[model samples]
Target: MTTLYGYYRSSAVYRVRIALNLKGLAYDQAPVNLVKGEQRSEANLARNPQGLVPVLESDEGTPLSQSMAICEYLDERYPEPPLLPADAEGRARVRALAQLVACEIHPLNNLRVLKYLVRELEVDEDAKLAWYRHWIIEGFDALETLLKRELGTGDFCHGDTPTLADICLVPQVFNAERFECNLSAFPTLRRIVDNCNALEPFQKAAPSEQPDAG
Candidate 1:
């Protein structure tokens, strides 16, 4: 059986869960407690050298790392409900939107970076939260503008159906809310996220619903 090694609250892992759920694929979860530093253990490092949550063990027993790569792999292997658009231009747009969140916003705010800020840089809780909110607002500002003005916008980020963009967007939004980031400025983003959350795929993949959720 396919298995996912990840923490319950990890947004990266959350992304994979949504993709797997959308594909209607059944998988077992192997929780690696990030707070306990279990991701850096020998077992997890063998699966993913980066010490990251969300190492997906394929049915063939091949381990895959990186959330976006794993998501694309699932889309390619199970093409029933495509996560990307059929057209070349549409695919490019969807990837760009997905990257805007995954590459730009998430990197600066992920657990490792936040841990480094507090543990190494001696950042206080207030300052750490300020840093988190600042980047979220900065990234969401650009995302909101693009989604609002882009003619391709539909019920989801790219079109009427959920795509890779929405898959990436929802987890980031979840983290932003957890950090208490003000999202009042991004109504378009909220509207699209609301649509995504209403679906069973997204709902089933929610962090709170995970077996390892604390």
Candidate 2:
């Protein structure tokens, strides 16, 4: 069977979990305690030199690193319910939405970055939280505009069905909520997240539902 190495709370890991569940692919979870620095351990480094969570070992024993790559791989391998749109333009839109969160928002607020601010740069607790909230608000504001004003948004970030954009969105919203980021301004983003959460696949992939959740 396929095996996933990840931490329960990692947004990137949460994304992969959702994608796998959405594809109806059965897989085993091998927890990597990121808070304990297990992601930097030698074993994890052997699989992913970047030492990131959500390393997916395929059923054929080949390992895959990076959440986006893993998600796209799963989509290509199992195309029943496509995560991307059929047309090139639509696919580009979906990818842009996903990258807005994964590349812009998430990287600035990731655990490693936060640790660097507190441990290395010596940022105070309040400042650290402010740093996190600032980026989330900036990113979500733009995301909300795109989702609300742009055509084709439905229950999910794309059309009526959940797609890659929705997979990236729900986890970011969860992280924002976890940090108590004020989300009243991004009603459209919240609505899409609410719709995604109502689905069984997304619920099962929630951080609270993961085996390694504490």
Local distance difference test scores for all models: 0.95, 0.94
List the candidates' TM-scores in order: 0.98, 0.98
Query: Can you write out model 2's per-residue Cα lDDT over 3-101, one digit (the tens) per residue?
Result: 999999999999999999999989999999998999999999999999888899875888898898899999988997999999999999999999999
Report the C-alpha displacement of residue 7, candidate 1, in angstroms: 0.7
Tens-digit lDDT string for candidate 1 (1-214): 6999999999999999999999999999999999999999999999999999899987689999999999999999999799999999999999999999999999999889999999999999999999999888999999999999999899999889999999999999999999888899999999999999999999999999999989
Clashing pairs in 2: none
Candidate 2: which stretches are off by over 4 Å? Answer: none
